[model samples]
Target: MTDDIRVLVIDDDFRVAGLHRDAVASVPGFTPLEAVHTLDAARQALRAHQPDLLLVDAYLPDGDGIRFVADTERDAFVLSAATDAVTVRRAINAGALAYLAKPFDAVALVDRLRRYARMRNLLGGDAALTQERIDRALSIMAGGAEPATVSRSATEQLILDGLGDDDEASAAEVAERVGISRATAQRHLAALATRGQVEVRLRYGTTGRPEHRYVRVGKR
Candidate 1:
């Protein structure tokens, strides 16, 4: 086990992967090995790099992120736009040290990574478990005591700003564009969908089923 934690990011979106790579690199005592777009590439990178941490996307073009965790014996985290309870539980079962719904703030991500680093350092043959330490770790990874403070008005503006030239976008796409967590983006999008401000549709792909996609309503 290396003292300097190495990270590998697995995400299909080049931009999102880049953002995460930068986020990890900006943290002290952490180094990013590489960011890959598919599970196959991720596995190959793991074989070659033997990374200390894996930041995996929930959905990938080649396979599910859970499969990667099952196949690898390394510490991992699930970074995804899907925050459904089922997905969260699956990630936990898959042995992820943490589950971060995208688009997580840079600071928030750094905080989680720092906690992981601390945990790794503190682990020893006789390290005793204490409630305080456990609580602190959980709090750090779960965004601490601060509730998500993004305003509905700000969310609407973010959605609008993320609109593409084609006038439509998926919830995940918009979340990435707006730099807010996917869960937050979906909440705002749900409100817009209900009010006829945006249209919601199923996005079918190779990820096993169709996912909800949101677009500005009445766009030409």
Candidate 2:
């Protein structure tokens, strides 16, 4: 049998689901199955495809995505815009291997997938396990890393300054406030999040996908 890891992408947003499907397909030794939207579709896909890993979001039309992951008892990780402490804790409690916030760059996702693959191989190997091997595998699963510290450029600083103390704004709002394009604002915000200079939070509306908003660290 093939050793490729099968991944199922579940998101309410069609475009975001497609983006994740492409991301999963880009990784070596990983196969992307059909991208599904609602929780009902996800359930059908799970029963039909039995994917090895799930790339799921928190908000869905039918129900909570993380709870679905818990109920299925599958090997999965959350790729979502839900950054609230309660949501994060619930995912962890429900046995999600990782909870990646939205707006992450493609490189970050690739690296996480690679590390997960490595961890999977180590755990699935037939060889006898040792302390060192087990420790290494667990470390990969933990995925702990110190936040990066980097110098900001002029444009980045302008974007940062646009936000008032204790205020949160989406990339578009930041862009308008800073007189830059939304794409430029998003890029700088992602960089700032990586550098631990800002925090990205998700705000769900009455309908549609959640909005990713950024705030200065220690402000929230």
Q: Count the backbone clashes (under 3 Å) in each candidate.
A: 3, 0
Least accurate 10 contiguous residues by lDDT in model 1: 141-150
Per-residue accuracy of model 1 over 1-220 as CA lDDT, tens digit each? 2366899999999999999999999987799987999998998898898998999998999889887886797889889999899999999988898888887798878877876764554242365744543443354445454124535675575576456335567776665445455787888889877888888787689879788877676665
lDDT of 1: 0.75
Q: Which consecutive 10 residues in model 2 have the weakest lDDT in total?
A: 143-152
Clashing pairs in 1: 102-182, 103-181, 103-182
TM-score of 1: 0.58
Q: Candidate 2, which segments miss by more than 4 Å at Cα?
A: 125-128, 144-220
The candidate scoring highest on TM-score is: 2
Q: Kindly provide the TM-score of model 2 when superposed on the true structure, using C-alpha atoms.
A: 0.63
In angstroms, how far off is 111's CA in candidate 2? 1.1
**Tens digits of lDDT, candidate 2, 1-220:** 2378999988989988888888888987799999999889988998898899998898898899989989999988898887899999999998888889998887777777877875675566475765544665576667643112312475576566566533799998776444445887899999999999999899999999999999987665
